[model samples]
Target: MHPVEDHGAPGSGGSRSAAGWLVLLALAGLAAFLLARPILTGPVAGLPAVAQSSSPYTVHRPAGGVRGGGIVNVDTELGYRGTLAAGTGIILDRDGLVLTNNHVIQGATALKATDTRTGRTFPAHVVGYDRSNDVAVIRLSGAKGAGLRPAAFGDSGKVSEGDAVTAKGNAGGKGGAPKIAQGRVTALEQTVIARDDSDGSSERLSGLIETDAAIRPGDSGGPLFNASGEVVGMDTAASAGFKMAKKGKGRGFAIPINRALGIAEQIRQGHGGAKIHIGRTAMLGVQVRPVDAGRTGSGGQSADGGQSGGQGGGQGGGAEVASTLPDTPADRLDVPTGAVITALDGEPVDSPNTLTDLLLRHHPGDRVALTYRMPGGQPVTQQITLASGPPQ
Candidate 1:
């Protein structure tokens, strides 16, 4: 989730940090605040101010018009500092169903897309996501019968090494006409580990189509067109420092379109599995960190340096609360900072990741018991109603 540097133009080449090479094709200024610990060292006045927009739905279109069937410039408003991130997507249906990478819309508070074909912008909502596979499906708001043109699909199984391909996307996050890069497929069924520098989280992606195309940032979720002008894959990760057979070109990877479409179909049918989450995510509204083992519950002090009062010892393992969002279920219940969340319902919560996985199993309006322990206190359980949260 490293914020992409704003080049402000297409094909403006730039060198990336060491971490950048591990993950590419993410959005500019993209940050997942919920997945990482927030900075609490400074006062609000010390932070730089970002101007707020009067209208959240307004999209800033580039000067030149773009042409393509069902391709779109996806814009996401993050939860932090009014920052806007951009990526690409492909239309799956005439009613504005779009397929994109999960990382493109991850941590987005608001979403909108400009169709490259029609040059029309529309608000959008997530239908479902397979976070492990990095695939997501979203539908345009009020576009059930919009008659949008869908991208041409090809059989990925028929693809082979040395095939000529074209990658098109909003390169460098400059939202004008889609940038085009031509190259030959170098390999098939390749695997790579994509890491998010912002949070140090990583996921393994396999069965990828490797190419020498320059798939830059903002090119994510765009189409990898074969010689026949049919999409064989979705543009995904690109290596910045890695060497390729073609010395001047960068190495790019794409998820096979056949696999992506299969997952998209599962999402469209509202099928939720271990790796796929359907609809909106449920929120506990509390930012947490791993509990420090050195800091045992004593002297009425919580694990996160907050004050608390109780008569018992600390729990060995749990997620320590760093802060709670206002008007959230955790806030309404007075779940104090530094408190250790030991469990959700009856499942043990050892870390923030575990807590997230447990919460994903439920949806908004679901009532579940939350178990926690204050500093120097015994375990306490309370029933809290979950609320709707931003897409994960």
Candidate 2:
């Protein structure tokens, strides 16, 4: 199970169509879903390069060598299998504040960014994130005096269909100057259900701008600029199995810049809500799955030597621990693999999602009471401390 949230644009229809999977434009060797249990896999090699532009629209590198622009190449070290992922970001302030998609840094253990303008790399930290909206803000260390340039933002509400647009980013995760793909806005207020290829979990993103621009992997969170070179949207998901903009082919989606900025502002002010998480995530360091009805008790038998059911022996609804990470709080406290977590700090944890939500209300070093039940046994409560984990 994974943490899930409900979010949609105002006045947008409440219907979610089961469209085909929309690939998130983040460059990584293997597909990994946000908030899912980690699985080690072999590295995938030889990602294809972005298609060359043949349309009349321009594809040249930006003038002044990226130092004049507000984009940066973001690299993240994942918590699993030495995996590295790359994406793009837009500078929001001279102090290295950046706006990006939450999925770009979802499972990051460590993050670093390179300023295209000066070619300087700096360590970065997440300021806050709204996973429901797929928006995040990160601040670059040692960038206070670097004189970073901020991207010019335009009113997304004023944008009209058929308006000329250009999407720019690290096209192939090649990590240098940003690449540009020019096209026109084909639609607005579009909604799409994006599914994670790794886990089959789906999210509905509403009020997006649709374009034919050749937005590809490694372009996630890059700026979608209008004809005036002002950002009107943030490049996000793209249609799969389409060639890159040959004769105006392929489809891309972008979150409106105005809406993204609004989320960023809330993060900057340290405001947290049901959907917004401020600062680092607290980790229980355990992999879990929903408890199955059949195997709910000790040795697959109830206390009365019968199948476990309502009040027979097993906890009715809770997350079953599959495994615990070594040296983490869960392992340190000897949380049994076959036990079901029934509560956290006296609050009932009915499922994996409930457990995740309860943990989000805490921080590192906070000691809390954990309650779990062994197979066919009474609930046991233990005190444990939480540790800091990678971005969720």
How well is each residue in 215-286 modelled by candidate 1, as lDDT tens digits?
766788888988887888888777744323355456788888777888888888788988889998888887
lDDT of 2: 0.68
- What's the CA error at residue 163 for candidate 2, in Å? 1.7
Q: Which pairs in model 1 have colliding backbones?
A: none
User: Alpha carbon lDDT of residue 319, candidate 2?
Assistant: 64
Candidate 1 stretches with Cα past 4 Å from truth are 1-68, 144-147, 240-249, 293-314
Model 2 C-alpha lDDT per residue in residues 151-234, reported as the tens digit of each score: 877677777778999998876667899998899988777766665454334556767787888787778888999888888888
Q: Superposing all C-alpha atoms, what RMSD in Å does each candidate have to the true structure?
A: 12.5, 12.2
Clashes (backbone N, CA, C under 3 Å), per candidate, total 0, 1
Alpha carbon lDDT of residue 150, candidate 1? 79
Global fold similarity of model 2 (TM-score):
0.76
Per-candidate Cα lDDT values, in order, are 0.67, 0.68
Candidate 1 lDDT (Cα, 0 to 1): 0.67
